[model samples]
Target: MSTVIAYVDGFNLYYGMRAKYGHRYYWLDLAALVRRVRPQDSLVGVRYFTAPVRGEPAAAANQSVYLDALAAHSPAEVETVLGRFAAKRLRCKTCRGPLTCACTPPVSHRTYEEKATDVAIGARLVEDSALRASDVALIVSADTDLVPAIEAAQRLDPARAIYMALPPGHMRPSRHFSTVGYFNINESALRACQLPALVKDAVSGAVYARPAKWH
Candidate 1:
């Protein structure tokens, strides 16, 4: 059986799921999801890339709980890679106009951009390919920014297969993801692969309950 390493784009998957199904699929089992996506392969591990929410305490807390649950799940090996959020302040174009202008003044607001995620994924993908970590690299994301990295990995070793799986109800995913194969992920699989309502840390023995917002 081919060995597979599943790379998950945490925000991409989360936003896609939220857009389509609210929080119905938020409580997920990474291992079970990977197995459902590729039942024929041996899942070596799952790398989930995401950044913590900076401003919303409730949302941040929810994210923490979910990550903890994933950590507690022993059936599937998962590694969490945290990125960062870049907050920038800028004035609106309209507000930058001349003082004599009758139009409303430009408003300055802070915007948060998710940083280092795609770059990290790309780098990790190439590094793993070069190291021959697995026969197949399964990236569960529709981000086209990864195209270049995917290309580099394939060039490193043409025999290394790169598989892509899009989130359920995802629309307009990149068509260039079929280098070697595609993994099927749907709402049914997500619904069936949910983690238990309460999970205990495999090592720490602390119990984590599913966030009520997620339920």
Candidate 2:
């Protein structure tokens, strides 16, 4: 059996799901979802890369709960790797005005961008390939930035199978790299792989519940 490690780009997947399917699918079971997508392989591990919400208290709360639930249920098979959020100033396209614009904005607005998520996913993909951690790497992302990493992994081991599981609503493949085959995340799969409303850790008796808003 081929051993598989799944690298999930959390922000990319989140936005894709939100754009097409909304928040109902947010309470996902990471390991179960990977297994559902790649049933032929032996799922060895899942690495979820994301950045914590900066100012949005509700988002942060929901994310915290979800992460805890994943850990509580699949501590051995799943890992959450966090990135940081950076605030950048928005500029006008026509005049290149810095935040302060006469047309729409009196001042520049701050938009938070997720940092290091793609890099983390890419690095892990290459690292896993180099270390022979798995026979295949299943990437759950649509970001083109990860193409370099996939290319590098192929260079390290041409025999290794690299597959892309595009998030919901994403149709285009990576411009720099190509996989053996790519699959789309469908609503049926997401619905079937959802975590229960609550999960509890037997060792510590800690309970993690899904946020009602996410449903």
TM-score for all predictions? 0.89, 0.93
- Model 1 lDDT per residue over 1-215, tens place: 99989899999889889988998789999888998878899989999999999878998999998998888885359999999998866554787632333547744456688998999999999999999999989988888899899999999978888887887665545676656566557889999999999999877889999998886
Which structure among the candidates has the greatest lDDT? 2
Give the candidate number with the greatest TM-score: 2
Which residue ranges in model 1 land beyond 4 Å of their true spot?
93-108, 178-180
Residue 147 error, candidate 1, Å = 0.5
* lDDT of model 1, residue 88: 64
Which residue pairs in candidate 1 have backbone atoms (N, alpha carbon, C) closer than 3 angstroms, thus clashing?
95-106
**Cα deviation of 18 in candidate 1 (Å)?**
0.3
